[model samples]
Target: MDYFIQQLINGITLGGVYALIALGYTMVYGVIQLINFAHGEFFAAGGYMGVILLNWFIGRGYMSTHPMICIGASVVLTMGYCAFLAMGVEKIAYKPLRSASRLAVLLSALGMSIFLQNAMMLTQGVFDKPYPIELAEGSLTVGGITVSYLQVIIVVFTVVLLVGLNLLVFKTRIGMAMRATAQDKVMSSLVAISSNRIISLTFAVGAGLAAAAGIMVGFYYGSVRYDMGFVPGIKAFAAAVLGGIGNITGAMLGGLIIGMVEVFGAGYISGQYKDVFAFIILIAVLYFKPTGIMGENVDDTRV
Candidate 1:
């Protein structure tokens, strides 16, 4: 009972992180129909940016003595840096390959991923950087189950992000432009919409969301490693596929479900097979619903 509840909370937190990462995958897929293999690196970038900025502030004694304020500052700096990095990635690795074969774009993306990871290693060194955590060490008791501040924050933030994303996609003109671009790039351009700009915007938004997840995960785990994005990337990709490759709402659903399965399966079944569990769910989803929970279309985009 209590144990189940505890694990459920853990799963939700994990899912929130994955969902955030998956949004990057889905958004990019929606526009360009290729997974940005380098998407995961943006997560690493966020972690690195946050830790470096926090340390700078701490060393300079510019912030108050409050740990939370320092953490918040670090998070904000990370988000901004990652947004820039995402836009830069669009200008460099992806823009040139947009018209190339899908396979070519995919390979290019893979190459970019490898390049960035190694570049970070060469520049930042191979050692894992630690994160500064400021949350008070305590848990809130609810319905006979204990939940930590970390879980609360993860769930809360994910909800806020999801709501904001929904509004951005459905209510705003930019979002309408995005949907139009997704529907038909040629038609969108015929209507005076810049497909190139929309694509870049999609990438930037996806990367920004992933950046938030990366920073949160770093703070939660108390460390940031250069290669830490791999597993999360795989899991988030699975979530994106499971929910529906190009469906925004589906990505959220898939991420939460994946998170729940991973956490509960590990706690109740075997920790060694947690990664396997995530993939197994993905496989099952693919097996039964070839197009995923939400169906995919010819354009690989959902308006």
Candidate 2:
């Protein structure tokens, strides 16, 4: 039971990160029907940006820190920069292909992914960068199971993010625009809704969330690499799909489930092939519920 609890905590932390990153994929797909394959790279980019900012700020005495202050600054800066990056990507690679076939947009996304990976490698060089956070370590015990400070932070932050997302999607004007755009772009445009702006906003939101996940991973795992986005990106994509690709709530639930499954699988089964567990779940979910847990593939409902 203790072991099970430990695995559960571990899974939740991993799941939180996955869910955060997966939100971008699901959101972009929800409205645009195109997977921004390069979305993952945005995670890596955000991490690098945060670390660089941290180093510069600290080096120049522009910032001093209590642990909380440092973390807050990193989080805010990372989110802003990533949001900008997302908007830029949408304006450049995606907006032009909005009127084109889905295949064209998808191919363009793949192109962006490749370009980013290569660009990061060329520019950042090949190395694993250290985390800027100097986190205080402690563990909280619940039901005889202990979870570390990092794990707790990951879970809490994820919950806050998901709650904020829920409010954003279900309670706001922009959310309505997003749903309207997702349901039918032509109709949305006819009604004076700027589908372009909504789509750009979607990408920006997704990028910001993914960057937050990247920040958490950087602090918890202790290193960030240029190619780090690939695995987490793929896993988060699986989470998005499992939850119901276009459903925001579904994405969140799926991420937690996937995280738990992978963690438990690694702990109890073989750590070497931990990744296979998510794919296996994905396959099973696909076979049973092709539209996803919360996804309405053919439904025309708007928020």
Candidate 3:
């Protein structure tokens, strides 16, 4: 039916965003076995960066006249900025706590999350900032279902990012170093690989992906907020867990699945419980099989 098709497209768009955010979670966990709870703030920060930069450009009377150039610039700058920001966060908050107990690191992550959230509030103010420029408002009707240009762009970009990430992780030397470190930090160091640098790179890459997602989401929704990352961040985390927390491909699969479920559940069921569906699926998956769809056994994944 047309309605189902519509929801499917919507689901895929939402899933793309979630998968982007989820990659940050999975990547950090894969390398360090520490969940960067503050990763969501990186998403929020990206949105903020995009809007602020666009606002500056619009003030100069240029963004609207050159949408593509403005957008491309914003994305690149935001990703770069957030990448460095994430590295700084790792150096300040996580690096010091690396050898601490798991509980200590977890608490540290939580504290950092709260700190970042409030810091955004204090710096950007507790108000929603609208994206200054709007692009690609056209829509196409296919099979009695209409899809917006923005949706198409988001999906395409998501695919490109995922493919690029796959090539990076599976085909490149840095990726091999990443895997080696993940497999055994001690052994990898013995072989001359720098575990510390690899870990920092992992954070930077993950934050960059999340930043891209944040910019897209801000443009799609027409607004950004200081606390906007909270809910979607939680959903993305659920996606990561659902697909197998430490697996890159699993994060993508889990994100799409979560997105579809959330959209379809809201469309066919009740919107009030839409968020609940993702968590329930996560709980069910964990209960049935402790290791995710593509995850290795617990013993094999020791940190």
**Whole-model Cα lDDT per candidate?**
0.85, 0.86, 0.91
Candidate 2 global Cα RMSD: 2.7
Write model 3 residue lDDT over 178-286, tens digit each, in one string: 9999889999999999999999999999999999999999989999999998888989998988888899999999999999999999999999999899988878887
Worst 10-residue lDDT window for candidate 2 reads 294-303
Model 3 lDDT, residue 11, Cα: 98
Per-structure clash totals for the candidates: 0, 0, 0
Using TM-score as the yardstick, the better of models 1 and 3 is 3
Q: Using TM-score as the measure, which candidate wins?
A: 3
Q: What is the alpha-carbon lDDT of model 1 when measured against the actual structure?
A: 0.85
Q: What TM-score does each of the candidates earn? A: 0.93, 0.93, 0.97
1 or 3, which is superior by lDDT? 3
Residue 231 lDDT, candidate 2, scale 0-100: 84
